[model samples]
Target chain A: MTSETTPKSLRTIPREKAFYFFTSIGNYTGLSASSLKDFLEKINQVNIKSLEFHLNRGDFEKWLNEVLEDKKLAEQLGRLQRSNLSGDILRSQLYEIVSRHYKELTTRAAFSM
Target chain B: MKLKNNTIALDATDYKILEALREDARQTYTDIGEQLGIAHSTVYDRIKRMEQYGIIKQYTTIVDAEKAGAKKITAIMTIYTEPKESEKVAEKLCKAPEILEVYTSLSEELQIIAKITAENQESLHTFIANSIAPLPGVLRIRTSILTKKFKENAFSIVSDPKKITFIKETRNIERRETV
Candidate 1:
């Protein structure tokens, strides 16, 4: 998947919201036999520079805990917690979200914080 | 992953069918239908779809490595190469049947990770020293022989998530706990 410079509403959302959104996309893509191993392989091969950015575990964890109380995002996150989605699927989903919301994402870096 | 093969989506029903096939690929459509409460024709359709989509790639028997006198070893090979030689090395590695799975990780230590299974240490040694080493851009090779298979196939764990918890417990369970 290729990255987009124009960001979407997804990029403006905090890490928790972005995680849940991408996680859902991962589920939809990986229902078959796709695993994280396959997804990571795809990401590593992708030509997108912004797509190559890796999120820190500490940041992910912090965002996860904060959003764990939000019922809606939590529900989506719970669906992803099942560990059914492939890593490649999640990567693709993030790539899609990033590309789709490139302009929005780029314009508002402060929104993410 | 490389887009060399086709991929298909699988539903819950399809997963059940896959579970049965994993244990016995020779199972009759009627038997699977009976167990799944579906008609024989439906079973056939599902299997056909799986084949067409590449979910059920090829059904083959699992030969016992020890019983067949085939000393098995599991080694994680890390290949380092420049961008120019990536395709060349990947193409060459794909031709070797011993290599089962390959993944490119997001780590500095390794770029491409390959899992290889061989008959004996000598054969495995030759495979690494000769077949893999000769690749155009191969810069390094790190291999670890599998002393024991704590957990092998991902198919089992993926098909049944319960296996994950079971494996975790089994790994921690003491031998004395059984008695």
Candidate 2:
């Protein structure tokens, strides 16, 4: 019998708040993982500056395709990827795309309060 | 005391005294003087001078958050705003009770990092959603929920003179090794 695997494309309303949706995205997109989760749960906290440092070095296109599974976003990011933009420019681009995605995901009828 | 031509200077002794007090703010001037091999009156004078020069802001206690019933939840938010509106955004963030600290970055993206705390997760979410997101000039916000707190160093001018020297030597060796 084959084990069932959940598709990463399927967007589900997180049981927690919208903030957690970003954290889950971070985990899925390889920004961070369970290794840091336990420490944060117990007593350690992640720094935003450090997260920015890691995201600046991460593969945005891969994150959009593999984790978010958004073809449109992946295509947009892919174009920017070829431009060879500086880290700051790339970050702003990614932020805009992700912000749009977040708005769409949260606006779904299921998530409406 | 004047060092050379009209330069007010802090000597090694002053630094040592400052270091001792940093380790224990409640440390008596007599004890600090004894440890640093200076007179109590000298310690008092140096502290007074430092205070006058605005080097020493205030002596305060660092309370344990967990023990104080204040460790509810914490998150780091990365905020984006209009480049010219960053100062206004930062000021607004500072006025919010949930926000503990705010930092502005000098980048094309009007980036601000805010540390927020709340009594519970739901309240924290409400505060962000109802309070922060609608604020004028806030373009986008990305939040990271802190899972652990590995270190939070107290504000100090210098940790230890010996350690600072050692760390410098270690960094020099590391640089040489890499090269």
Which TM-score value belongs to model 2? 0.53
List, residue by residue over A31-98, the lDDT tens digit for candidate 1: 11122222234444543321222231122223434532323333333444343344566556544433
The local distance difference test score of model 2 is: 0.61
Cα-based lDDT for every prediction:
0.53, 0.61
lDDT of candidate 1 over B64-147, digit per residue (tens) = 777897667766666665557766777778888999877766566435678788877667755664466545565555566667
**Candidate 2 clashing pairs, residues 3+ apart or interchain:** A39-B148, A40-B147, A40-B148, A41-B147, A43-B148, A43-B149, A44-B148, A44-B149, A45-B148, A45-B149
Error of 1 at B1 (Å): 24
Tell me, what's the RMSD of every candidate? 24.2, 16.7
Q: Give the runs in model 1 whose Cα sits over 4 Å from its true position.
A: A1-113, B1-9, B154-179
- State candidate 2's DockQ: 0.03
In Å, residue B10's CA in model 1 sits off its true spot by 3.2
* Candidate 1 chain B, run of 10 with poorest lDDT: B1-10
